[model samples]
Target: MKYTTDDVHNRVKKILYGLTGITLADNKDIMISNRIDKLKRDSKYKGDIMDLLHLVEEGSYVTEFINSFTTNKTHFFREDFHFLDLKNRAIPQLAKSGNKINMYCSASSTGEEPYSMAMTLLEVQDEIGKKLNASVIATDIDTNVLQYAANGVYRYSKSSKEFPEWIKPSKYFKRRIEKNLAGEEILIKVKDELKKMLTFQVMNLNDNTYPFSKNQFDIVFCRNVLIYFSAEDQNKILKKLFSHLKIGGTLYLGHSENPQDLVNYVKRVGQNIFIKEKEAF
Candidate 1:
């Protein structure tokens, strides 16, 4: 059962695109086959990749396909400047209005980015000596990652990569050494205070409309995920994200992403950062 045939690969690609609107490049054929192989082993589906694709097309094991295909590579404060800007510039200006600030981490993979947002807001609150009433909604299409995010635990070794050298992990996380059946391992967990600020949910960004109310978010972090989409889909998602943002709200994109079609609606303020025009509404 060779699943690397062009016909089988195209079938799998069509199934993925239909479900998630992600366009797979031809070079990704081997990558897709590898993911499907893992899925085959995990699900114990004693069949070839074509069988898996048929099951996916029949709406069976769809969630597993999505969880397997969607990329979830992220770390806390992966982009340092974004958090700095949020803490020093965005929070301060928004705080001056004395209103609750709403934020959406649109692709909160494994909880790092959303937790980073919480930490930044908490730091600002301590500096101002007042509650910012900041609330964060973290959403991702991958339910498996969402569950891991909700648990808020990670290997200390890996989690250590979350912050920049200047920031200390102890400031935001509580570290503990615990012995398991395997061995003694150090684990880092998100502090309860920071965990309280985030609400995690499963969401598909490919939807025509998001579940959020209009003009709801002050900041939307849809970083790193747009590169997987086509230009038309990227513009479509950007337009939808704009509609969800409040006037003068900010949008953060991945470093490699540029909102070519969205410049009319949002003014670029920083590298891969844009502010919704006050007149956008």
Candidate 2:
């Protein structure tokens, strides 16, 4: 069946909102078209956009549709200061308390953020001459990205700009030359030591309740992805994240995000950083 741009936009918007709680504004028409068109060409989808939408409704191509539209822009140490704070402040405080550092990296797109966290934790552990038992639970709504994160392989050339400068990549990642259907490409895969510090899983922030118990995580990194959500949804998710964090735990948000709604529960400690208030329940 023939589909107009409006038809495609409305259909895709519904599918995305239903599945991921991400609302595509009217201005995103071109982006939606480009992504869907790319999906058609790359996946060799024979059907029209409407047919693809029908398939998505039936849960046949849901993952592909979500992966195609959902933005997964991430890099190692994307916000360098957060990692710096983790090393210089957070880890030191946790080390002094002698408690295992439990961190959750929500929206860990393809592993860069979590790996950066793991590396910083390792560095702090070495610096303090103490064995800091640090573990990061990385999760994303996109299953495909989670799988990529689990594999712990990334395109080194593309990631060069955002790669952390303090730690040598060679120390935590081994260079590998691999041949694919396209051609030869240089890739960097995370070493076993860094991989051991992370546990990647598939999770949706829109879920009514997360699987984790209350006060489980000492730190939560729910960065970048919150801007895509509606204000009400953002508040809901933030409250849920707050519940998972320990009273004195830290929550790291994207630089552009505001934590005004959470003022009573968390105190702004730094730019885009909020610490759960000691008296907050």
Candidate 3:
């Protein structure tokens, strides 16, 4: 049996929407099929390709597709300079405010960005000296990635090999073998300090309203993911994100993306960085 491309196209769209609320564009056949093919291979499907399609029709396919489709490219300190800027500028000013500082990682893939953020806050722990209470809320649309983030483990795969060792755990991570869901063995660990400050959740950026309101965040790192969205959707997301940021809070975008062309809500801070100029609350 053979599944027509159209059969795959429709099924894949439904699966993406149901699992992650990601609505695939009609023209995304190649992308969808490519992801589905990867899932088939990962699942070790022993049947015909059409039979594999039927398995997808039975549900649980969305979970498998998410495991394959969601991009998880990240590392321990991919952009060390960004952390420097946070330490030098953002953290100090927020500490002065004497408010409980909140940071959000919007596209926090595989946990690196938020963990880096936690480490930055921890770096200033002595300086702030009880003046600031901080927590990093990391959210991603992919539950599969979120699971790995929650586990706080890394194998230093090809995606993460380039990660600089300077910021690597100082007497923290200790490797220990553990069994996976399939009873396979692997080793990984993260520092207790880093683990305590960060929390990961499954969140869709396109959700009409963020669960938390009151414009509470001091910084929101909504990077890279918007490149995959349409212009209208991107604008919608930015507007929603702005409503959740503290008045003087900053929003970080991908290296190549800009919010300037889209709205006047935030003032430019630096490269792909924007600050909300509407008086702090």
Candidate 4:
């Protein structure tokens, strides 16, 4: 059995933060420690807790550690009103130009949020009797989760169960069946239409410069992630995200995030939603 002490936990936390600019909140040591212990057991790592910490500090097995430590909690139609706002408010305005709509979903975990955006785009275009020609870029720091997102499969008990009620899921998803030597498994898979609308990539928000061109995205969703950073870091990230938004593009943040500091650059258009400001559009 493997166990981690307070010192071990602190060192492990520091290692993960240094690698991913994402910090665990206070009082999360128990959860971090448990995951570390699980790693030790699963890998059958011979090193004790402190020894394992040093290995991680020296950048050995760092990717696995980072993958295990990062939080990737998300679901379809999360913060439902954001998608509603997209369908009823933002998309219509964006569709006015008859140009392709571009959306960015940062910290997109396992595809749900971006896919939700795709579903909304599909729904709105159908209602208006026009193809908005929209696209979604879904990004995350965890390679493991990104792979899962690109695969576009979800368990029936989890997100798949909720897919049907949203718009017309049949247009975007299909039943997936799998058979293996060990056993059989069943899941729902995203159809090509939805997959074609999304491009999944590995992105770390901590980078000083993002890969996106300035004023590139028509809608941005950077939800449920700012809580992990310091206030200063949060401001830095928000400014970068704002730079990527077109003048009238909408930005959706986590419900618990504090965006009061960004008043100079953005105005609140809805709950936890802001539109970039230039005083022109």
The TM-scores, one per candidate, come to 0.93, 0.92, 0.78, 0.90
Clashing pairs in 2: none
Kindly state the number of residue pairs that clash in model 2. 0
Per-candidate clashes come to: 0, 0, 0, 0
lDDT of 1 by residue, 1-281 (tens): 44447888788778888898888999997798788776786667886677777888999888888888888999888888999888888888899999999999998989989988888888888888988888999999989999999999877775467676645679778899999998989888887888888999998889989999999999999999999999999988888888889988889999988876778878888878889885343
Pick the winner on lDDT between candidates 2 and 4: 2
**lDDT, candidate 3, 38-143, per-residue tens:** 8888778866656665676677454666677777777765566667667778888898878888999998988978887887777776556754588999998777
Cα lDDT for residue 91, model 2? 75
lDDT of 2 by residue, 152-224 (tens): 9888775367766678788899999989998988899899999999999889999999989899999899999
Show where candidate 2 strays beyond 4 Å: 1-3, 41-44, 158-161, 177-185, 278-281
In terms of lDDT, model 4 sits at: 0.84
> How many pairs in model 1 have backbone atoms within 3 A of each other, for residues 3 or more apart or on separate chains, i.e. clashes?
0
User: What would you estimate as the lDDT of candidate 2?
Assistant: 0.87
lDDT of 4 by residue, 6-82 (tens): 67777877887788778877799778867887678655788677877788788787767877888889988888889
Ranking by TM-score: 1, 2, 4, 3
Best candidate, TM-score: 1
The count of backbone overlaps in candidate 3 is 0
lDDT of each: 0.86, 0.87, 0.74, 0.84
| Model 3 lDDT on a 0 to 1 scale | 0.74
